[model samples]
Structure formats: structure tokens, C-alpha cells
Target: MEMNILIERLQALMAKGGRQILGIAGPPGSAKSTIARGLAESMGRAAVVVPMDGFHLANDELVRLGRRDRKGAPDTFDIAGYRALLDRLREGGPEVVYAPRFDRETETAVAGAIPVGPDVRLVITEGNYLLLDTPGWADIRSRLDEAWFLDLGAEARQARLVARRVRHGDTADAAAEWVRTVDEPNARLIAPSADRADVVIRLDA
Candidate 1:
């Protein structure tokens, strides 16, 4: 979708008053973060981007759970904590709401990273499982005022995933292998959730 059009749509949604939570869900490498950040930038202080990756389990915890190899899978996150935060964000309050952020370089979640104020009219939270309908994930959809699913061709998505892995220190071959073994399965799981989104956005490279 054109960025200008999306901005206008979100602006219209914000015009209704009260706090609005906008969710952008997609498979890895679908530019969820990029789009969410762009929207927040366009809206300025009126909006804040709170990413779901911040709910990722610590690497040590993942290893203990034997889920290190599939870190981005559904069960690898703190779903309860994510849900609680969403509840609080939806409720709105007088004080600043601090949200965690995931650092790709460290592959760790830094607590109290992003601050969302009560005055903020829009909260853009993007991630892989926003529209997922499993036990823990099902609660997220209702919290969003509007849910958007980003759709990208598998070839382009996989290429971007591989490039991202390489940029994060994996060798080219290792990156490709990881994308095939880990990301592809997750992508398959995420694709169906697009049906739950209010709108599906076809994205270009």
C-alpha cells in the first residue's frame, strides 16, 4: 500500500478520539518494524511504536526450554506479559507506559525502553503473532483497534530474511540454512493469520 494513503487512514482512525492501537502483523522480513517506525515518525509524538519482539524469552531461558533453535516460534515469547502490557496500553493511564525493546545485535530484550504517554493517540505494535489465534495469542487481536497484515512474496521475504541474518553476523550459507529451517516454518504459521487482519497490505521490496 502507498505510505501516504496508510498515513491518512491511520490519521482518520485517530480522529475518532481516545487511544487507538494499530497492529501490523507479518512473517519475518516483511518490514513490520520499518513500516511501524515510519508510521510513528510521520505521526510524531502522537504515536509510539511498541514492538512485540520485546516479549521474546531470554536466550538462556530459550536454551533451558530447549527452544533456542526455534527462538522466533510462537511459544518462545512471554505471551502473558505481552498480553498484560497490551491491556495496560489499551486502558490508558496518566503516567508514562514503558515498553521493552528487542536489540537485534544483542538478541535480547531491554526492559523499559520505549515510553508511551497517555496523550499519545496511536500505538503501533508490530510483530509476527499479533493476529495468531492460538491460546495465548488469541487475546491480542481484540486489543487492536485495527489490524494490518503485511504480505510479501515468499522469494523476496526469504531473501530479505537471509540478508538480515547475514547482517547480524551469520555466514551467508548459515543465514540461508537458518532461514530455511527456522524462519520458513514460522512464516507458514504466520501466513494464515492474515485472514484475521482488518486489512492485508501487499508490500514491495
Candidate 2:
């Protein structure tokens, strides 16, 4: 769908005059953050993005659990915490609600980094597992007013993933290997959840 049309749709939803949550779900490197940020920018103060990446487990915790290598996998996040934030966003109180944000530079979650005030009408949350039916993740879909799955060709998506890792300081060979052994498996797990989304969108590169 065109970005303009999606913006219009979100505007219409916001017109109802209560907080609305929109979830954008897709595999790694599907540009979910980009799209969510674009929508929030277009909407100005009425919208705020609270990304699921912020729920990522600390690197220390991942290492302790022996899951550091598969850091982006399903179990690598604090799903309960993520869900609790969604609940608060959905409830909409008088006070400001602060949300965590993931810092790629340090690879850690920065607490209370993004604030969602009471006046914000829409909360756009994007992540890989929003539509997953797994134990902790299945509750996510029900919290959103709408859910969108971003789709991209596997080869193109994988290439982007590799490039991202390299840009983040991984050697080219290490990035390629990580994409093969780690990201690809997560992508496969995520693909099936697309069927659960309210809309599957394929935006142009």
C-alpha cells in the first residue's frame, strides 16, 4: 500500500478520539522501524512509535542464558514487559507513559527513552513477533487496533540483514554467516505469522 493511503487510514482510526494501537510485524530487516517512524512523523504529535526492539533482553542476560548467538530469536525479549506496556497504552491514563528504546550502538535497552503522553492518539508498535501464536507472543495481536505485516522478498530481505550487521561492525563474512545460521531461522518462524495480520503490506524499496 502507498504510504499516503496508510496514513489516511490511520488518521481515520484516530478520528474516533481514543488511543489506538497499530502493530507492524515482519521478519528482521523488513523495515518495520522505518515505516513506523515515517507514520509517526507524518502524524506529528498525535502519534508516537514504541518499538518492540526496546523489549530486547540485555546482552548480559542473553549471555547468561547461553542465547547470545541467537539474540534476535523469539526468546530473546522480555515478552511480559512488552505486553504490560501495551496494556498501559491501551488503557490511556492522565499521566505520561515512558517506553524503552533499543540502542543499536550499545546493543542495550534504554529505559524510559520515549514518552507517550495522554494527548497522543495513536501508538505505533513494530516488531517481528507481534503476530506470533507462541505462548507469550499470541496475546500481542489482540492488543492492537490494527496489525500490518511488512513483506519483502527473502533474498532481498536477507541481503539487507547482512548489510545491516556489517554496518553495525560485524565483518562481512561474520554477517553473512549470522544471517544464514540465525536470522534465516527467525525469518521462517516469522513468515507464517503474516497470515494473522490484518493487512500484509509490501512497500517499495
Best by lDDT: 1
lDDT over C-alpha atoms for residue 64 of model 1: 99
Q: Each prediction's Cα lDDT score? A: 0.93, 0.92
lDDT at residue 196 of model 2 (Cα atoms): 93
Model 2 C-alpha lDDT per residue in residues 39-155, reported as the tens digit of each score: 999989989999999999998999999999788899999999999999999889898999999998788899999999999898999999999999999989999999999998888
- TM-score per prediction, in order, is 0.97, 0.95
Clashes of 2: 0
Q: Write the per-residue lDDT of candidate 1 for residues 94-205, one digit (tens) a residue.
A: 9899999999999899999999988989999999999999999999999899999999999999998898889889999999999999888999999999999999999877
lDDT of 2 at 116: 97
Q: Which stretches of model 1 miss by more than 4 angstroms?
A: none
RMSD, model 1, all Cα superposed?
1.0
How many pairs collide in each candidate, listed in order? 0, 0
Which is the leading candidate under TM-score?
A: 1
